[model samples]
Target: MAAPRSVEPADLSPLAWRLLRVAADYEQRTVEREIDDILQAHISMLENGSRALSPSRCNTLFALYSAELTEEQIRAIAENF
Candidate 1:
């Protein structure tokens, strides 16, 4: 099989963007801290400690955002990550 394509913040769908915004808001509220930049926070999380999003983190993020994402989109996320 060919190598998976990279998933950039720009490549994300509007639903993906909404998921990031919600996740950022959820973290800020639960942690009692503000995320000055939601998009940056998401990028950091996706790139956490590596050039790519770790599988575990990707699964976790997918689960967290699954409520707002379609299965096809989640599958796309899996493929990208």
Candidate 2:
């Protein structure tokens, strides 16, 4: 089976795990420098959940991946951290 491209809230490393997948997907889709800035850390660290995303950065991600996601959804995602 293919690995999921988004993390579940109940996962052990919810924020980091979901951010990693979202970041990778964003990277693949665009050459935006902002995305580069967030993933400055090595991919290994990101994949392993050693790194977590900040709220401002999450705003950038939300803008890119799921612009239609509501503020309530964003808040819910934040609560996962």
lDDT of each: 0.44, 0.46
TM per candidate: 0.32, 0.35
- 31-65 per-residue lDDT for model 2 (tens digits): 24547565435333544567656656544554554
lDDT tens string, model 1, 37-70? 2344454444443234445544444444554545
Off by over 4 Å in 2: 1-25, 28-36, 40-47, 68-81
> What TM-score should be assigned to candidate 2?
0.35
Off by over 4 Å in 1: 1-42, 45-50, 72-81
Worst 10 residues of 2 by lDDT: 1-10
Model 1 poorest ten-residue lDDT run: 28-37
